[model samples]
Target: MTDQFDEDTGDYPLVMPGPLWKRFKQTLADFVLLLVNKCKSSYVFDQRLMDGVIQLLTGLADSQVRAFRHTSTFIAMKLSSALVDVAFGVGGSESKEYKT
Candidate 1:
């Protein structure tokens, strides 16, 4: 069996997404979301890592590619929830690492 899509799936040969599906484009948003979700604790108490996050997202916004812009925007939206969690310290007391 070939790696290509099977007729059972009914997915036609894709042409629209040829350029859109650049290397790691699909994983970019998910990776950022995972990072932001897991980093809430550090974000609440640290400035350096957060600064890097801000700078990275800002620089990604400077790209003219649709994939970069779209992924960055989606990551930014999801990141807001993480920021809110950090703002209210939602997981601090629940986190074992922060336990006294």
Candidate 2:
């Protein structure tokens, strides 16, 4: 997702933060939140599915392991909390914490 012109210009070696990247990240975060919010009691209680979610995140984060560590942790926490709420039959009562 790099620009050839930018690279040829010899401006920087690191990936530059651009609008498209920002939008893509926002889209990704939204998708993750949607997936997490869809967790019902059945999915929450399904050990296999929970493990899959964890594995998926870990695998994806492996690309930028160091940078994604905290982000992945936060996503994991939210997913866990959502699962717990659904399991406890309290999923309808949205918490302020999850809004972020």
Best by lDDT: 1
**Candidate 2 off by > 4 Å:** 1-16, 58-100
lDDT of 1 by residue, 10-94 (tens): 3322212465554345465566657767765566358888778778877766665544555556667767765776655666656
| lDDT to native, each model | 0.58, 0.57
Give the Cα error of residue 68 in candidate 2, in Å. 6.0
- Give the clash count for model 1: 0
Scored by lDDT, model 2 comes in at: 0.57
Model 2 weakest lDDT span, ten residues long = 6-15
Off by over 4 Å in 1: 1-34, 89-100
Instruction: Give per-model TM-scores.
Output: 0.50, 0.47
lDDT of 2 at 38: 72
